[model samples]
Structure formats: C-alpha cells, structure tokens
Target: MKIRLWLIMAIMLAAIVLAATGCGATTGPSTIVTSQQNTGVWVSGQGKVTAVPDVAILTLGVQVQESSVAQAQSEAAAAMNAVTKALGDKGVAGKDIQTQRFTIYPIMRWDESKLQEVLVGYRVENSITAKIRKVDDTGSVIDAVVTAGGNFTVINGLSFTIDDPTDLLGQARELAMKDARNKASQLASEGGVKLGAPLYINESGGFIPIIQVPIARPGIGTPPS
Candidate 1:
C-alpha cells in the first residue's frame, strides 16, 4: 500500500511539470487590430506654362581663306574689328560682346582615284557671341552687322531667352503641387480610401523660347482674317 501511494504521487508531479512547460511555450503572433483609420493614396503630376522671352542671343563670325596663314588671319581680324565697332556704335555695352571662337585651320584636299593628299590654303574664323537685353532690336542689330562689312553668310539665326526664370519656376512648382493634390484626392475617392498629406515633393526648372513667325503679303483680300 505504501509503494502504491508513492507511485501515485510521482505520477501527479510529472503531470504538473508537463502542464507548466506547456504554459511557458511561446504564443502565436498577436492580432493586428485596425480602427477607422483611412488608407493613403499616392500620385504624380506635371505642369507647364508659357512666357514671353525678354532677351536675345546672336552669334556672328567672319571666315577668310588665303594662301598664307598671316594673310588669312589679317583679313579675319579686320572683319571682326569692324563688327565690334558696329556693335559699339549701336550702344551695345563692351561686356555684352564676347569672342566665342578664334581658330585657324589648314584646308585639306584628297584625291580618291590617285590616293594623293594635298594641303590647301589656311582658313581663319573669328566669332563673337552677344547677349542683347532688348529683344526688339535683334533684327536691327543683324542688319547693322551685315552693312558693316560683316559677312552675313556667317551670321547664325538668333536664339531667344528669358532674363529671369526664378518667378516662372516658382509658378510651375505651385501648379505641380496643386495638380498632385487633386490627383491624390481623385484616386482616394475612387478606391474608397482617404487622401493624406504629401509624403514628398519635387520640382524642376522651366523655360520657353519665343519663335518668330514669317508672313507674306500678297494682294490682300480681307487680310485673310
């Protein structure tokens, strides 16, 4: 009877140990309780605007070729000097007129049939780049250069630019932000979610050039209105 009692006590102790160990084991992941918080929507947007150009840039040059390098260089220099004087006479500041390129290169000729190479006369080119703050005078300036012995053949077309781009870029950024907000709101409404504040914002600079339009005047009938 005593042995039987001892066995029974041992069995009870083992059962208690198993129960304790089972309770100490790790539990499963806790449940994530979601409330009435709305889901966020993402969006991207772009904006563009046009503004008139306030400045003009002109590139003018003279090219001369002669049998001797010195002669070629002298002719190019003389033409460029005349161009500079013309610009000065027109009230263009010395700071605005800048020499952009001055080069002297040997002309080359090759005969494909005979496989012969020949060195022709040297060609010298001198160019100047000028920025004019007054856009209205751009055409007149080109005319002056041509009349002042500057080879009009070397005159490239004019390019237009804006004097200040900061204000324009700021306007573009504001428009971009507004567009982004509208897009986000629209997406949220369609997806049955809520729109939140922007997580990020980015912007880029913008500029548009003015293009000249050519018009021909024939016998006018109602001016083609």
Candidate 2:
C-alpha cells in the first residue's frame, strides 16, 4: 500500500508541474499578427501650360577699375546712374528697375615667379535688373544703356517670362486634378472596386516654361585710367 501511495503522489506531482508550465497548451509562442487595411488608391498627375513671354528681364551693369577703392566706386556709381537714366528714357518705370548686385573687390594677379598674388587695382561692379514691358524694345534699351554708360558697361544676361503667372498656374492645377480623377476612375474600374470621394488632395507644383535668350556681349571700350 505504501508503494502504491508513492506512485499516486508521483503522478499528481507530474500533473501539477505540467499545469504550472502550461505544457499542453495549444497557443503558439505568443504570436502577433499585423495587417494594413487597404483604404484607397493613390495616383499622381501632371499638367503643363505654355505661352509666349510678354516681358523681358535684363541684367545690366557697369564695372570700373581704379587705383583706389573710392575712385573705382565713384566711377562705377556714375556709370550706373547714366545707365538708369537711359532705362528711364526707354520708358522703363522706376518700379521696374532694381539694383541687383554691387560689389567692390581688389583685383589680384597671381605671380607665378614669386608664388604670391599681387594687387593690381580695385574693381567696382554695379548691376541692375530692368523689366521691359515692351519686349521689342529690349535691343534698343540695351544699346541705349551701352551708349550712355560708355566704357564700363556690361550686359550679363537676358531672360523672357510672363509678368503674371496666376492664370497659368490656375489652369495647370485644374488640368492636374482632372487628370488625377480620370486615372483614379480607370484604376477603380480595372480593380472591380468603387472609387470613393476624394478624402484628400494635394498639388505638387505648376510648370513654367523658360525662354532662354541668347547671350549678347555688348562692346564697351577700355576704361580710362
């Protein structure tokens, strides 16, 4: 009887250990499942609008060299003033003329023999951007400035663009939205699903075409020392 009792106690202890450890449980090692619910389809669309530019932008300037910084700056200022008067003569409004850049720096020549840089003279550059409403007058305005500013005149670059781009941007936005709607509808048809109303909308950007003007280097005689 004592042997039988010991055997029963051993069986009971094994049952208690299995219950504590959950050995017979079917639940796998605490598995976690993640799922992304499909909400809607995403589509991207683009639109472009182009038109001939009505305004011309020119970067005109005068650069002068002198032995002293004050002298160079004075000469540059005089030349730039003359250029501004020339623009005014061509009917460019005061609001349309803006000083773009003005700089004064010492001219340094690299001396290869001495392995150093030698100061030659002070160079002053004064520049302004003029928006010409009359695109056809671009050449005449440039010529007039050159004549007025004389030997220090410099024509940096020219570009053509529309004065106002609001209308163009609006048209492009409408077209882009239409394109997106059409694409979404097509996708919904192919996938055998109903397209829901747009819950969100975003505009990437509008395209503006730039008309590159040929670089024209104006001839300016050497500055008087």
Q: Which candidate leads the pack in lDDT?
A: 2
Clash totals for all candidate models: 0, 0
lDDT of 2 by residue, 65-154 (tens): 887888888888888899999999999999999999888888787889999998878888888899988888887888899999988899
State the displacement of the C-alpha of residue 17, model 2, in Å, after optimal TM-score superposition. 57
For model 2, state the Cα shift of residue 146 in Å: 1.5
Cα lDDT of all candidates, in order?
A: 0.57, 0.68
Looking at candidate 2, the ten consecutive residues that score lowest on lDDT are 7-16
Deviation (Å) of 132 in candidate 1: 1.5
lDDT by residue (1-225, candidate 1, tens digit) is 011100000000010000011223422223212331122334565556566666677777777777778987777777778877887787678999988888988877785777997666788877788777777776677677766744422675466666676776666666666676676666656655554334334344345544432322112011000
Give the runs in model 1 whose Cα sits over 4 Å from its true position.
Answer: 1-39, 109-115, 209-225
Q: After superposition, how far is residue 172 of candidate 2 from its true place, in Å?
A: 0.6
